[model samples]
Target: MSLPVPPGPQYADKQFYINRGYHQIPKLRLSMDRIVKETVGLRPFRPSGPRIEAEQLGSKTIVHNYGHGGSGWSLSWGTGNMARNLVMATPERKIALLGCGTVGIATARLLQESGCEVTIYTKDVPPNVTSNLATGTWSPASRVCDPAVAKPEFRGVWEDATRYSFRRFQFLLGLNDIACWTDEYSVRNEVPTASEHSAGGEVYEIPGLIPERVRLGKKEHPFAADFVTRRSNLMFNIPSYLHYHLQDFLAFGGKVKIHEIKKLEDIDALPEKVVVNCMGLGAKPIFNDDELIPVSGQLSCLIPQSDIQYKLSTEGANFIARKDGIYLGSNGIVGNWDTTPSKEQTEKVVGILQEVMKNMRG
Candidate 1:
């Protein structure tokens, strides 16, 4: 057997490469890389399950369902289910919904299903709205909190949220802009493979798993290690999706009123006695709710790069996505709340991307 040639030092931590006469030759790198994995856990709801109890808030008339953090979209369907139960006991014909984001839309739809005329009173509509600003990935696990700590009375709330959103999206699986269920591959640092005893199949040693892009692969394709790709979905086009949702709402005889509430007295002015709040990131001043705080996040959109359909992230402060454009940014950067990319940061990301592209280009 031929001995593996001893190679010279090059990039520290990188394996050395040697050629006919060249020593420490740089190895071929790939433009594609893995981005850091995010545990998309929803924000934990505070101790105030019902700041206004059911009986106190006019249970026979009012239903409060709001304060969902980032997972608002993901948990909307389920949260709506619980809220619908409130009206189930009552025979109310009209209901008022605060906020017109994903949560509001879903709750309004659920209310309409119960033969109730739903009015969405919000300062903004869809498309030109905050819901449209989301990346629209289909991970419905977060946005609320760890449901265990919720009041025992709210035990069924969390489960209802997960099940409702899951089944709802399943029903709208192939809808137009609502959800662009495409192939997304999430590559990451090497990790231990799952054991067959737990996996119920042959344990494949996957050094790199294609995490996001959901695409059917060509037959007989080879991989570096045991890799698994699933149906990764994202809200590729938020504007279009919001339009579709708005149309659905209007079609169902739901009305949207644009009005901003400055104080608790504003909510008191609503004609409908029953109110379901679906305001996202708006609980700060609307109800004088001090628990809601803004944990700011920023992203950058670059020129489109179709060749890079996949997303990449290192650990933190580094994320690269190829969508309508090559989107890249870091949430971990300090003193950088500005959404507009700084020239220095832009150049730095561009350089990192350029190196990745050079190494991976076939």
Candidate 2:
């Protein structure tokens, strides 16, 4: 029951075990007693797609770079480069970068490498930022933009960012767990319908950019499902990844100032005439972007297991094994701003995985 190796870069690498048959399935202990913590993150979603263009605000030229939705981490390097190019066109050598989250840090690092002085002004840092709460998967198109409202030209921007980011992430592998590849399994009772596949909404795909999903025979895997498909993709260990980037930025002479920007006037007061906005969801009130909304996502983590190396996705739940814990989450609720952890939601998510592990054939 060995599966046919999918034709892709990952398959070409024998280390991925693309053509290998299954061994004994490792028993996964998933129970409420193992629950460690619950956290929430608000994705900065813009129905019109991410705003990466520049705008004029009084005496300052603000290069807008926020509103990335769930793709902040996946597309960070790409969008960061785009934002850097925008700033390079200006004559200002000293720049003020807003926000200290994933996007902001990436943008600041790029700006620094381009020979520009960067100073970050933010209300919070890692572990307190929204990016820290992310599940850390490479989801470049997750709720990026609404199909009905996005312009025709936006597709090209999305594709370009996705491709550029994918290439950049490859260089960071094997560096203190900043980023690495992980096998993801999608298990289901029946073949997924087209609509079910598109349940996440309009997706902009880049063909051949990642390994193709290969269906595994019943004996090839141990998941309790009628069908199982596997694909290898990159994921970030959010804590260490962010810490590495922040440390790099500081070591490279980048400056950080803890300040809150409440209005346009606050931005105008900055000494740097050129500014890059990586404020994520905070851009809504300060920049007066009505289209920006908060998409709430919650995760419940369990005690980490050394053998749980692969990610899993069922109909309504997802599991990612990070160094911190085994994270469990479901499709988040749109337009929800409450960041409070939900006990009931945690129970539901953990219960689903508990049932799946309990039914494992191995």
Candidate 3:
């Protein structure tokens, strides 16, 4: 099926023909029997954007740094640097960092580098934290904030964090797959309208950081859809990525304690006078942040396929090929706090992929 070409110079520039040397890639195996595990994660989405400023809670200084939504993994390094700056302003060198996810570990390492003694207080560790379940990608603006509610200054913050994080991710490439680039293909019957692209409303965007998407011709790819576009973007193998950072933190003398903060008084009882809060969704309860909404997402992983190296996205579902497994996920359900894996959702997601695989053309 031939899709109607978009009528614009923008789309024209993105069009490209495949090279004669190009070869068809191996097809992904999609079946319910292949499913090995299913997990859910809650993205801490604040309509007003991420809180990065320092607030004094009684005698202790609390550096607020949560509510990144789905961009926590993507914007971690940059936001962590921002939180570290706030901690540096205070005279306290002994610091207590809350949560042990990507944000917490990133900030803890940054603080240690600045000569501050850091200890992580969290209820869970790697592979168990919310960030571990992320569909790891460079999506700094995904459900980040509500433009109507977010302050105008947030645009600058988002850009700075995105640019810095992009540069930092580049340095980790080829390092045992801690971070690497993968081709992402978007397949659909029609080109997405501008409004459809930003269904959650405009947040912030930084173009030219990743390669420009190239529209694929009918004979160029094996996808089932009429309209296909591919672009190279950075992806994190979360398991190894977090393990590497956690080891780095420990090697640098950083400490971690398995403690859950249930209230503000629990934070005040800490020995450290200055604290950095990286509690992604956990902030809703401890900080009483009613503005923080939980955007629940689930990922069903199949056994790892070494040949499937790229990512694919269709209408309602997406797939990410990682060293650990093939991750299958869909759009997050906003205001959903339930973390249990939905059998119905899993079957639907797998069914979509199975159909796509069935329709593949060589």
Candidate 4:
């Protein structure tokens, strides 16, 4: 039998508590390390243009959108929304989506709403593969290139995409079991409250608040900061969430074809002439997009700790509670594409957690 769902008493709580005493997540420690090592920035890449040559594809007929790097999830809804606006001018009644990841899913859904027949051609589907492996945090970490090297117009697109996605997530939160949106506390080290490090601060509040049991103490903080703690709402268990999206797609009459293509021509050959390619890092091989590099992220999971309902990060080490277990990650430091958790890495993560907890007690 499938395991029982974790209790959601605290998650349902509406009034998010901001731990003012000490921070738990290691923002200060991680920032200090990044500044010292000078490796804290995201990969240096940006959209060169609509990943497709308008002249080559016949402008005003086929639309091109993809190459989001890492912000694909955080910014996809907005980008798809913008892409749909462009479709208004296209005489074509249907659109073909190239990838089935979050971007492809959002694009297909949006196209359906526009009264268009959408078909997604992908080798993978929800829960089984692609994107569900993501830690699924809201932070726009990664997917940024050097401003000097990026095109001027692309920055505005990124900005609009991000804002648009934030609102869409808000709307999905109340949609029931379909989308699992919850406020999760992101604990961090206590920096001086007046410092810029406190932008937006921790202990964020989310909508659709469900009353949950409170776990608080006068000095209940993590090991990093002076009484560092937080009450934030972060999405957990992405597979279940993706399942809802897939179901919704089918219910809306959208069709998904499970097929692997060896060349971009295969995609171009589809019955639907208008194609929007959102192949993520896969673009490197499919479209010979060497610009689309995969920056790997590795996370170590401790045996489930229900009471560990908050997240803590310091010096690249991070711990966030999820439906599966407490997700411990060194964030960007654990090496990209080495997605597996090693014994040494696991031990190191435990050490980091000990330090964070110890610091919080002090």
Off by over 4 Å in 1: 1-55, 58-62, 142-156, 190-231, 234-236, 303-313, 317-326, 329-355
Question: What lDDT tens digits, residue by residue, belong to model 4 across residues 104-157?
Answer: 788778888889888888887865454665566664424344354567776666
Q: Per-residue lDDT of 98-206 in model 3, one digit per residue for the tens?
A: 9999999989988999999999999999989999998887788888998899888889999998888888898889889999999888778778653233223335667
lDDT tens readout by residue for model 1, 267-336: 7788987777776656557656665543333444555545545444322223333344445543322222
Query: lDDT at 216 for candidate 4?
Result: 35
Q: State, as a TM-score between 0 and 1, how close model 4 is to the true structure.
A: 0.72
Ranked by TM-score from best down, the candidates are: 2, 3, 4, 1
Cα misplacement distance, residue 124 of candidate 1 (Å): 1.7
Q: Please give each candidate's TM-score.
A: 0.66, 0.93, 0.92, 0.72
Off by over 4 Å in 4: 1-62, 177-233, 333-340, 358-362
How many clashes in each structure? 22, 0, 0, 30
In candidate 2, list every pair of residues with a backbone clash: none
lDDT rank order: 3, 2, 4, 1
For candidate 3, list the clashing residue pairs, or say none. Answer: none
* Overall local distance difference test of candidate 3: 0.85
Instruction: Return model 4's CA RMSD, one decimal.
Output: 9.8
Q: Stretches of candidate 2 above 4 Å error?
A: 1-22, 193-202
